[model samples]
Target: MRKMKLPESFLFEAGPRAVLLLHAYTGSANDVRLLGRELQRHNYTVYAPQFRGHASERFEDILDEGSPDKWFADVVEATRFLKEKGYEEIAVMGLSMGGIMATRALEVGDYIGGGSFNSPIHHIGKTRLPETFISLYRSFNKRMGVPDARIQDSIPRIKTKRTQQLEEIAEFSKKVAEDLNQINVPYYIASSGNDELIDPANGQILKEALMPYTEVTYHEFPELTHVITVGPNRESFETTVIAFLNKLNWKEG
Candidate 1:
């Protein structure tokens, strides 16, 4: 539960119709800046805030603090930030961990519409995401010049403890999935047929869960992988997002 002094959040002011982009687990706002810029080019005000413990260099920080409950609180605050800035119409979107947040945001807020990109929404128990995160933690530490030998004990301990937080995320995802029908606004869902961390089949679960009660926009990029907001095929994904936003009945203030 420590703060990182990272000045890496994105706020591109363009129009009154705003967007809140949430980054994936352990990723900074840099993960979504490409898509944010694309949205900005189309005259949307894009705000990509940094999640707690992500901006810091220590992997333990996120392991200890990046629970879904805390992230939901952050997303709520981010939405309020936009409303205070005179933007009444806001759409939320996120990648992976952020996708979960965006879906939950719709349940509680009067959002115009929002969705997720390559989010793991089905069979949370099957994904090797925690292992992926732990691997990423080691890679990041290596990037910071910390060798594996020195951090041997710490990494294992962190891995064991972080599983609890991962469980919290699973619980949150299940709740959001079950509550998808409660949302009155449109929801967008994207999937990668070849995502390394999350199963592509989860897209069907997302579509089926929300389509029965509310409007849902489901799209898939077969050649792409997770975090489409920043890498190859990102532009294509952004176009799909723009089309979704265009169809929304926004009440800009």
Candidate 2:
């Protein structure tokens, strides 16, 4: 079968300093499109890469291929692409699951600083049945070749996969938490106090984890949800990001 074409990623070129924006799990480049545009207006080159299995014809594809490793690969590729283009100073920002990737990128990529929004450093609620069922359903899908199953027929599977993916993400987040001290770059961490998906305490968890090694700026918005980037106070979110970037002092030669 011919692979489905993913949605267009965003790249805006203007200056030697660059910013790589990463979207949430199961989300497309569109999640961070507005932020990318804002950075571009500041004359900062920006790139938002679409993750594998995301933005495809079916959400099932995300279940089959969207692992943390694959998402991190997207981050790695975007950062290297910017470096190859001669951007001497680069920063990475991630939202939700992308936050984990951005945090991990600081350890592997040559970035000056990074930021994360509404990310869970430690997952809440302990449930294993969902992931168990998701594994079974995925196997059933592969055995039956039911890639185009209807919503009613696949809703349980979809929910299971989403839960399972979060479990996987939590595992990775725990690993990142353990090694947070190795990430010696300045970081901006924020979360909503009433985030419906992740516990608001995660923001403090991340901030505290990084405090021993690097500069950490933490913020809490009591009114916003997990998806703060596109919330009612989205302008405020954008302003916060712009301010963080402006403070980097990466002057082009």
Candidate 3:
């Protein structure tokens, strides 16, 4: 039998609340599918969209399209689509880079009841070329070769070291740091003290940003790595999320 191609978007019907899941840079809908399944047990209708340049490329190609505006637009479109489908009680969640987009979505999406960011990249913060990180990136770029300029121009742009795609992850960092006082919504942010991919400082910056928000909760796992929240440490992570949701009167099915 011939295989059928699934839509770039995946929707899971469960509870009354509709929760949109945004995966990290380079991750496909599959990356957050586990989280979606978990949320379903809590009666959340999950919608995870495979954003542009994702779900069908190497990590490098996906990163090539990693502009804030692009993902932000995808989230906006996804939220609008869900709203049209009668999902009024909507919440947004993302992992790593996707978390940044989730925050931006809050600005434009209607009726965002809540949000969560796991191992979020709040700010790139003056890259100063963390020698190791830059070296790794450059090495990967060398292996990946240069991407097509036209293709790169097709997505929403962000600022970076290059003249192209200038949404500059650093700009997101600085803006959030200065204007964190403006976010007035319930948010749950989780991080690991030992997460090498995203510095602990980033999580602290997020905490400071959401401090003024009435229902903000921050949890840290000192011994886990960037992806640990999904694997071995997931139980603790899930427990915290449940408690946080319960504090807001979020119940399971």
The TM-scores, one per candidate, come to 0.94, 0.84, 0.74
Question: Which lDDT tens digits does candidate 1 get at residues 113-232?
Answer: 899887875654367787888788777677777766876767768778788887777788889887887788888998987788778888878888888788999998988887777677
What's the candidate order when arranged by decreasing TM-score? 1, 2, 3
Q: How well does candidate 3 score on lDDT at residue 40?
A: 78
Top-TM-score candidate index: 1
Pick the winner on TM-score between candidates 2 and 3.
2
Off by over 4 Å in 3: 1-8, 58-60, 63-66, 116-167, 176-178, 249-253
TM-score of 3: 0.74
- What overall lDDT goes with each candidate model? 0.84, 0.78, 0.63
Clashes of each: 0, 0, 8
Q: What is the lDDT of candidate 3?
A: 0.63
* Model 2: per-residue Cα lDDT over 51-108, one tens digit each: 8887765557777987888888878888888888888789998988888899999876
TM-score of 2: 0.84
Pairs of residues at least 3 apart in sequence or in different chains that clash in candidate 2 = none
Q: List the residue pairs that clash in candidate 3.
A: 15-43, 158-165, 158-166, 158-167, 158-168, 159-166, 159-167, 159-168
Sort the predicted structures by lDDT, highest score first.
Answer: 1, 2, 3
Evaluated at residue 97, the lDDT of candidate 3 is 63
